[model samples]
Target: MNSRRDLLKTVGAGMLLKLIPVGAFAADLVKFVDVRLWPADEYTRVTLEHAGAIKYKHFLIENPWRMVIDLLDMRLDTTLKDLTSRLQADDPFVQQIRVAQYDANTVRLVFDLKTEVKPEIFTIEPIAEYKNRFVVDFYPKYPNDPLLALLQKEDPMLREDEISRALRLAEAETNGTLKLESGSAGSAPNTEVAKTEPNAPVNSKPKFEVRRMITVAIDPGHGGEDPGAIGKGGTYEKNVVLAISKRLKTEIDKMPGMRAMLTRNGDFFVPLNTRVKKARSVNADLFVSVHADAFIRPTAGGSSVYVLSERGATSTAAKWIANKENASDLIGGVNIKGTDAQLAKVLLDLSTTAQINDSLKLGDAVLGNLGKVNRLHKPRVEQAGFAVLRAPDIPSILIETAFISNPAEEKQLTNAAHQQKLAEAIAKGIANYFAKNPPVARTPLT
Candidate 1:
C-alpha cells in the first residue's frame, strides 16, 4: 500500500511540472549597479547600470518639458539613488532629476528639462567594464549647428591676439608657462605676437585683410566607456592621444589660415559614427584620428599611419587591426536596434576613391614627419577599411603614434616631452598636406 502511494505521488508531481511554464521560479532580483551622467554640447547622456536585463519604458512629458523613465521588475538601490547627485548644475538640457520607488518592483526617474528635446533611450548589452545598461540621451529639438558654432563673430581686435597666443602656447608648454592650457579655454588669450604672416590667402571672395580658416578635425580615439588599449604601466591610450591631440590643436590654431576642431574636447565617449559626423558637420577640410597601438607581444614598437582602403585591407595585420577598431561600437555600446539613417548612409555615395587617394597623400605627409620624431612601424602608410576614415568627401587619416605594448615605447608615449614632440610632428605634417593640396570649397549639403 505504501509503495503504491509513493508511485502515485511521483506521477502527480511529474504531471504538475509539465503544466508549469519555464523560469517560473527564477530569482526576481535586478541589482542596480551605478549611474553615470555625461553632459556635453552635443548631448547629455544618463546611464543606468544594472546586473541583469532591465525592463524600462521612457516617455516625454510636455508643458514643463520633462522625461519620465519607469523601470520594471527592479529595485532602486543605493547606487542608483545617487543619480540625482550625478547631475551637474550647468547641464545644458536637464534642469533637475527626480527619482523614486513608484511602487513594488518599479522604479521611476523624472528628468526636468529646461527646453524641448528629442530623447533616445535604449538598452545596451554588457561590454568592457560595464554591465547591462539603460541609456537616455537628450538632444535639443532644434540642435545647434556645428558649422554655425564654429563660426562666431569675434571682435576684430581680438583675432590677431588669439593667433599669437596659440603660437606662444606651444613653446609655453615646454617652458612650463602654459598657465592657460586645455583647461583654461575661456580665459583671455595673451595679446603678445610672436609673428604674423604678411600674405595669407583670403578664401571665398573675402576682400578684408583676413584669411579663410581651414578647419582640421583632430579626433582622439576612444574615451569614457571605452578606455581603449592599456599599457603595462597602467597608462590609457585615450588619455595619451587626447593630450597629443590638444597639443596638435594648439599648434594648428597658431598658424595662419588654419584652425583645428576636436571631435571631443573632454574624456567623453563620442561614438565612432558621431566622430565622423562631427567632422563633416563642421565642413572640416581634413580629419586626423590619433591613437596609440598595442600588440600581444611586448616586442612591437614604433608608429604607423593608415588610410581607408576601398577594396579590402592591404595586409593581414591591417585587416585584423581594422576589424578590432570597427568593434568600438560594440565596446562603446551603441543603440543597435534604433535606426540612425544619417549614420547608416554607408559611404556608398561613390567618390570614395578620390577621398582615399587624398587621404593617402595626407598619410604620406604625416608619416614622413612622424618618422623624424619616432621609430617608423612601417616605411609606408598602410591601407585598411578604418570605419572612422569613411567620410565620403573629407580627406581622413589615422596615426598610431607608437606601440604602447612595448615597455620602453610605453614609457615614452606617457612622457609629456614625447607627447609634445609627437604633436609638433603631426601639426607639421598637416601643414605640409595643406600647402601642397589646398582645399577646394564645395556647395554646402542641403
Candidate 2:
C-alpha cells in the first residue's frame, strides 16, 4: 500500500511540472529582436527593438570619448551581437560598438566614439509594425549653424556682386529715388534705380539696395524610420520625395539671388517641430515640404498641394491626409522626454492668418505648375492643419508629388526624367511667385 501511494505522488508531481508555462522562466529576460543604426551629419541614431520593456542605464566617458549602456535582466544574444556589425565607415559619431555579457543577468554595450558627443537616450512604446524600442542619439557637442553652412556654399565673387547690387538698391530706396517694376516672365522683379533728380550725377557713389539673399527651406517629408508610405511595388515615399527635393534644390540653386536649404540631406528622422525650427533659424522666406501621397485604393492618383488652415481642413480627404501626416512623430519614434515643449506650444498657439494668406498664393502658383507635370488631385490647393506647415511667420506649403499607391504613378515617381520635370515645374512656380511678390528686405545686405 505504501509503494502504491508513493507512485501516485510521483505521477502527480510530474503532471504539475508539465502544466506550468514553458515561458515562465524565460519571461524575466527580455530578448532583442532587431537593431538599426542611422548616421548623418546632424546626428547618429541607434535603435534596439526588443520583445518587451527593458531597464537600462547609460553613461559617457571622456579622455578618449566613449558611451556605455547596461541593460538589466537581458541576455547578450545573436540579435544584440549583430549591433557590432552595423557601424559604417563614414559614421560621424561612433567608431565601433562592443557588446558582451557584463554579468549573469546584464548585457553591456560600449560605443567607441570618433569625437565628443551629447547623447540622448530614451524608449518608445510599440506602434504600427514596430515593437518596444530603445533609442540613442549622438549629437555634436557644438552643433554647426545651418545658416552659416549655407552661406559658405556660395561663390565668393557672386556673393560680393549680390551684396554690391543690394547695397545700391538700399541706398537708392533710402534716398526715395528707387522705382521697382515687374520683371519679365520667370525673372525676379526688376529694380529701377532712378535718380532723386534727373540731373543727378551718374558717377555719384551709388547707394546699394538692402535686399538680402532669398533662402528657401526645402523639406523632404518622412525619412529614416518613417517611410511615409509604401506602394504595392515596394516604393518608399520617403525615397521618392527626397529624390524630388534634391532635384528641386539643384534647380533653385541655379536661380540668381536665391539659395536652398534642405531640412534633411540624408535618410534620418527629424521631428515636425524641429523641421519648423530649422526653417525659422535660417530665416527662410518660403517653406516647401515635398511628399508622395498614398491612399487605400490603388486607383487613387494625381498630385496635390496643401497649406495651413486655421479653422479646419478644406475637405474630408484633406483632413485624412493631415491626420496621417501628423502621426509621423509616433512612427518615427520621437523621444518624448527630449522634445522641445516650449517650441511645440509656440508653433501650435501662434496665429498664422497672414502666413496662410501668403501660403495660399504660393500654393496656387505651385499647383498651377504641378498640373503641367501630372494630373491634379484637386484643381486648387487644399488646406489642412499639417504640423510641419505651422510656422507662423513663414509661408509654408506641402506638395503631394503624386499618388504613390497607384501602380502607374509609382512607376513615374521612380523615373529620373519625370522627377526632373517635376523639379523644373516647381522651380518655375517659385520664380513666378517671386516675380509677383518680391521678398521684402529682412536684413541689410552684408
Best by lDDT: 2
lDDT string, candidate 1, 281-356, tens digits: 7678899999987887899888899999988888887787787677777776677766466555765545588888
Tens digits of per-residue lDDT for model 2, 57-129: 9999999999999999788889889999999989999998999999977899999999999999999999988
Cα displacement (angstroms), candidate 1, residue 302, comes to 1.5
Indicate which candidate wins on TM-score: 2
**How far out, in Å, is residue 73 in model 2?**
0.8
The global Cα lDDT (0 to 1) of model 1 is 0.80
The 10-residue segment of model 1 with minimum total lDDT is 201-210
C-alpha RMSD of each candidate structure in angstroms: 11.3, 8.2
TM-score of every candidate? 0.79, 0.84
- The residue ranges of model 1 lying beyond 4 angstroms of the native Cα positions read 1-29, 153-210, 337-339, 443-446
Computed on alpha carbons, the lDDT of every model, listed in order, comes to 0.80, 0.86
User: Which portions of model 2 show Cα errors greater than 4 Å?
Assistant: 1-30, 156-211, 443-446
